[model samples]
Target: MKPLLLLDVDGVLNPMGRPTIDYRRYRCTIGTEVYTVHLNPRHGRRLLDLALSTGSELVWATTWEHHANEWIAPRIGLPALPVITMGPGRPRSEHGEMFKTPHVAAYAGRRPFVWFDDQVWAEDEEYLRVSQGLRDFLLVHVDPRHGLTREHLGMAHEWLTLTGFSQGP
Candidate 1:
């Protein structure tokens, strides 16, 4: 099975506050909230290339849900990939982990995955560590202010290489 590269939009692709150069600003309306998002189109190509090189699949694991496919994918130049649904009502985690943790674990099942999110916490890490049928997962904590950067992608590439998930050297 191909490994998964999970992406979060708000804090991973669309950064918080004003972004530096190379980012284009867009106004997006999700529900009643009018959000100002900074997105770099290059990020889409980089992520797609990473997935291709690693033989992995890109998946949306954000609160945006199906909306990500509508609003995010086109902006980033990514095709409509799979989304990991949080289900109706978006239940919170009963455990100390982040609300998305349980849902992500359920979607990933036994497949190796790399998750990028700004809200990943120690509790989430511990929860995944002890969870049954889990292996070779990487939790990448992205700074909400900066969003994703080349260094982050480099780290992911390194992880894929070190973990032997890369399609080739």
Candidate 2:
């Protein structure tokens, strides 16, 4: 089984939930709550295309799952893909399972995995710091930017190759 690509949409794909040049930031209302997020249809398309071409399965770890598929995915030329939904595999946390990484293991069937998110940090840099199982999963953090910038995409592509998620970047 290929390790799953546990992706966060806002900062990783759509850019940080803020305003900036090159992209316009907008608030997205999902369910009863609203969140500020950036959207670049081009970046979304490239990400979707990369994942598809690499044969990497993208499981949503972001709250944007509901609207991501509805509006964003279509703009990127992709149908709604299966989302991991809420927590990947861990019990819900007081943080509403946002820190959930265990689920990546389950979602990936314990295969080598890479998690791309702005939320992961030095604390979670080494999986040993989080969990023994997570030690094998690659966690890549993206800097806050207007949208999914080229730097992050390059890192994602490189990490994917290193983890054997795909052959070429």
Candidate 3:
């Protein structure tokens, strides 16, 4: 089975901490709140290429949830991908792990997956290593100050190839 690629928006795609010059600003409304986000246009193509090369399904794992599809996808030139639902009351781990860790593990189930986010901590990694029992999984932490860079994409591609998910040409 192809691996799953979980994507986060704020830090991974939007890089909110970075200078505004690197992205195009857009104003979007989610629920009753109107917010502005800066998204790098090149990242969509990079992500799409990674997904296609690895035969992995791209999924939205951001807090924005479905709103990512509505606002971020179009701006980045990505189609609407599946979103990970954050149910009532945030899920937490006993070791101060990320709230999304359990949800991501549940979504991945027995499937091999890769998750990209800025907030992943060592606790989350330890939780996955001990509890998830995943043989082939990658958790990449992208710097929010830089978002997704070509170097990051290269690392992901290398991992996919090393894991036998991509038959590089």
Query: Whole-model Cα lDDT per candidate?
Result: 0.87, 0.61, 0.85
lDDT by residue (1-169, candidate 2, tens digit) is: 6546666776676764565554545666667887765566566676666676566666666656566776556654566766655533446543222455444445555566567777776655544334444444667777656445667666766777776667333
Error of 3 at 52 (Å): 0.9
Error of 3 at 121 (Å): 1.7
RMSD of 2: 4.0
RMSD of each: 1.6, 4.0, 1.5
Q: Best candidate, lDDT-wise? A: 1
Considering only N, C-alpha and C atoms within 3 Å, which residue pairs clash in candidate 1?
Answer: none
In model 2, which regions exceed 4 Å deviation? Answer: 17-21, 24-27, 87-98, 127-130, 145-147, 167-169
Candidate 1 vs candidate 2, lDDT winner? 1
Alpha-carbon deviation at 103 in model 3, angstroms:
0.5
Error of 2 at 118 (Å): 1.0
The true-versus-predicted C-alpha distance at residue 147 of model 2, in Å, is 4.1
**What lDDT score is found at residue 74 in candidate 3?**
94
Model 1 residue runs over 4 Å out of place are: none
Candidate 2's error at 13, in angstroms? 2.9
Please provide, for model 1 over 1-169, each residue's C-alpha lDDT reduced to its tens digit, 9 standing for 90 to 100: 7888999999899988678888898888988998778899999999998998888889999988898988888998999989999877756666588889999999998888889999998888888888644678888999999999988888888898899877643
